[model samples]
Target chain A: MSNLKKDSLFAGSVKDAAAGGLVALALFGMMIGMQADVATGLGGQLGINYRWGAVAIAVVIVFAGRLLLNLFVWKSDKPVTRTVGSLLPKASSFSGLGRFATPVFLVLAVVLPFLLTYFLGTRGSRQYLDLAILVTTYVMLGWGLNIVVGLAGLLDLGYVAFYAVGAYSYALLAQYFGFSFWVCLPLAGILAAFWGIILGFPVLRLRGDYLAIVTLAFGEIIRVVLLNWYDFTGGPDGLSNIPRPSFFGLDFERGEGNFADFFGLEYNSIHRIIFLYYVILAMALVTNLVTMRLRKLPIGRAWEALREDEIACRSLGINTTNTKLTAFALGAMFGGFAGSFFATRQGFISPESFTFMESAVILAIVVLGGLGSQIGVVIAAVVMIGGFEFFRGLEEYRMLVFGLLMVVIMVWRPRGLISVRTPSISLSGKAKGISADLVQEGHG
Target chain B: MSNWDNNPVLAIEHLTMRFGGLVAVGDLSFNVGRGDITALIGPNGAGKTTVFNCATGFYKPTEGRIVMNRANGEHYLLERMPDFQISAKAKVARTFQNIRLFGGMTLLENLMVAQHNPLMLASNFTIGGVFGLSGFKSAERKAVDKARYWLDKTGLLDRADGPAADLPYGDQRRLEIARAMCSGPELLCLDEPAAGLNPKESAELNTLLNAIRDEHATSILLIEHDMSVVMEISDHVVVLDYGEKISDGTPEQVKNDPKVIAAYLGVPDDEVDDVEEEVGL
Candidate 1:
């Protein structure tokens, strides 16, 4: 102690480093300190193997890392925001380059399939096109759920039930009624919106956790009904042989009277993929367009106002009942459209596809994109769905990476990416985005 | 009480609100004369808010009728209606004791939300908005103009684009009133408009309330604890104590009432009933 540096700052850094080492020890003690493996190379009983060296290394690294952070970041006199999240990047980029971000992304989405085909050629383009189609479907779903969770501030854990409804509506209608894909698409959306209203009525009075629990149960109930009702729905066998969407009335199945024959082009399966890609792109863009328009309408303002303060909304004579139901119906309508497209794209419908995890992922996209932000939904969907696909080879670490990313995002931008809100009706045409803190994230 | 034979915007007849066994308000009645400022004055927990809530359709009175009469001679049974109908069909607007501005919306947006009924009808319930109909566009412009008009009146036009949560305490209070006015209400109910304001702001609120009564055809009904505010601009005063009316008259008449003084100044317990009876409650 007598030989140690006299400076208090040095002492403080040492103390912080020591504390970090202790925390790392406490955290890693069980997970990494002792491994469960056979000590011998030969077959032996599985037992605890002490790895004190690993623990020692972890502690040393933690200590060194903490020391560096304290010296260069935390204790610096330059007013540093000392946190890993804050260290990454401030979410202040809603200006400058942000002005063109939407247009750039829109252009990229429109030309993605052709761009991929141009670069990767015929054989290689299929996989990337499929990935793009899958991501666009999720973008559509994220925007749909954004209506309920983001704009209206209603926490709906049963959102996938509407998706399931749309998928099944299209499948059953085609299988039984002999309807085409185009006919079933709008019908599927209508049916899903009807179900949304049915779900909305019972949960009208419930708020926060109660609403979440009911919606979760509702989603499960829909899946359970689909799974167990074998006679009409084919039970666990699931509905299959759903028809594909036609260009006007033309199919793309590499035969006479198909898309390629009609267009006088090669009968490549990539044509179908390309067509489906455009179909989903168009669908996703329609959802975005409708939602953006809604945000400026009285109904959209009513939804947002209800989210901010339901009592205030009611006091102002805004019909909260209609507002909530419209949110559910409109949100479910988009989910339904996406679901119908999903069924057509996959040519199969099953209960396994519409699970609670799907709802959570869509919700995660909405939350990560920032509630009430239309463009945020697009960015979050791409980053999450695309990133998930990118890490598909590392299946076990994929979730670990995803969870770590979520934690980082929560700490960094607590309100989600692009959290700031553009005012719906700005007197000054160029009014700046409202701070994320000023935007209501909704109670539920 | 001033007679409302010529006209009355709101009439609360035998209004009784009972929560379980406790009587929050019991057999209370008052009439707000058309285009006049009527103040409901009471101390803490004297059922002033309860009466306001009942009148605004937040609470259905256990018994009695809350009648709102428009200039067209159409009257609404307020307690029979929902909270929104009270504000919408009955043309009544209210502010909270604790301000309930849509904190996320801008001052202009907050007022525009109050004009939702009119704009919703004009936009054809949002379907027409998608098509960019000229009618809806013009309605939106008119709605903005109305919001701006209220904003200018409240002196918040400069900060119309700013978020409501960012306003100062006094400005937020005034903004609440402005938002209520944008609804085009025949009757406006204000709850503690001068709450938490300094003397200067309180005086400004007095001027604003007087200006509203003078300039607009809207009648004002308010719940106020601030005696200075109650006495300055009130055209009529109704005092409540322990869920019962102790006095009802003009501000000068009510201010000098012995029972009003006794209820406010806290007289001897034995003389309390005497004061209550002398006032014929």
Candidate 2:
């Protein structure tokens, strides 16, 4: 048994290294391309005193650097163990910390920005705050979809429909009734959840590809409705000049009634951005908490059972229709929250903001992170979103690079970044950490 | 035989299952006596599995009444119930011809899922489960204990955490039986449980069946091609040929019947005398 585990560990490390190497090589090639472009100006018409010898030297230097790093790691005894230990510091603690980790990380995420701004000062913190907020939103979206696609095994191609519903609900409600952000948030979630139930009822008998196609159609239908409904949604133009959230009636603008003036501090737009960041962070954390708790519940188990085998789940007396509906409702509710946050953040709402591309990116994060893994989703969001932002300078080739990266990661780990852990039901009625052996056994 | 007052747990009357013009089970009538291990034996396309499917509500009979009497005095018209509800509410559990345990789940989970109804009942539709209720926890613990108990019974306790598909063929067959037994059904229907099992595994299965009959008072209806398994464990044997009943009697009686011999041994009716003479029957 130990030998088998060791072999698997070895195989996993080798695959991970190969993926990392491919990513590094791609980045290196991009850097070389940029240098070449600088040497050869517009349309390759202007040429500088660039030598092919220098390019060869640069390539050799990079190759030697990579080889040396590989040799250092390979020469070290117990390289696999060392690599895995560094990658997953709490590998053994995963089972024990599974339940507590999500909440703990959530609290830390909420407090991290404030701590960073306080300690490091607010010099160029807006970018970091924006990245954090973006990552959090995707994390929430991934968790929401995980309920339907990961737990219930429902392929929802148009999950963005629910997200659009939430954003529009918030936009329309706040616009018409002059409601607060807090009030509009839950309203959006409720409306989106209602749509989820509606979607669920029609696809009760469908499974697999049929269910996926219907969901894709439903998404398109929602988008089309938003596009055609000129009176309510303003047609393709969408709702604009949406109200920004205030801090207890004190606006964040520069004036006597502004938030900074009320609090007796110098006004900076970063404050508003940071405040909004934390607000979205809190929302995302709540989404994660609810999903994690639900997973331990009977409904969660039913979803998993459905995913594993629907026929067997039915045989066990589980009401599959109810289970599927609950999954859809819960997932949609979170998507609604993200949508509301997006509307509030941008101070505008548009159909273009909730396109199918948004859904694809969110789904990609969920899949890359590992289905049903909260932490994996967060990490995936950070890497994919942060990488996309960083590669903005790459121009037309950015998407091509991102696509290659996705393919590389998928080939390296077909099961996703973090595979689903085996569920543990203790004899003492206490929840225990999921064991790796148990996960292997369950996934076999 | 026991008194007729102890009516059969499962009774199929005029059960006829047809696909297009091809009749799989035609006017089949049989009574699976309570606490009896009944074996249904037939050649390929003889409709033994078809009868099991009709009884389990997988394929509704074209013309039949499947009456199943639970030990709790609740009688279920199995043919009328949906496929899922039949196994859930009627307490009529069945194992497939090919072992069909949830391969992605652990061996223990496969068994626990079989006890799904009872667990859900204890948790009251899982409201208690969401609140982390102590009662639900206790119920979950009970499920785990039950799963472990059955795993031990099947000698698969050591492999409880392993995936069902990872088990060897014999172990997989045993695991399937354990999963069905975990459902706590009054009537258990096993389709070819002894298929691909060696002599030792077959003997072990016989022991398990006998134990289930004596301890749980489960009425077992089995479809088996292995004569040894049928002859050793079955209290009654029913033979089918061309979707029609050929013989129904005790194992010894069925073994001695000329029709059963011709159907199973493949000796032509006209040449049976010559074959019997040659074999010194």
Which predicted model would earn the best lDDT?
1
* Interface RMSD (Å) of candidate 2: 4.1
**Regions of candidate 1 where Cα sits further than 4 Å from its true position:** A1-89, A96-98, B268-281
TM-score of chain B of each: 0.93, 0.94
A139-241, model 2: which lDDT tens digit per residue?
Answer: 8898899778877778887899999999999999988898888899999999999999999999888877788788888988899899989999998888988
Pairs that clash in candidate 2: A95-A433
Predicted structure 1, TM vs. truth = 0.93
Clashing pairs in 1: A230-A235
Model number with the top DockQ: 1
Instruction: List fnat per candidate, in order.
Output: 0.70, 0.26
> lDDT tens string, model 1, B1-281?
35553577898999898999999998998788998889999789999999999998889899999899998889899999999988888889999999998888888789888999999988899989887888988899999998888888888898988899999999999999999998888899999999999999999899899888878888899998887888788889999998989998899889778788778868776686776567544
In candidate 2, residue B201 scores what lDDT?
A: 91
Docking class of 2: acceptable
Clashes of each: 1, 1
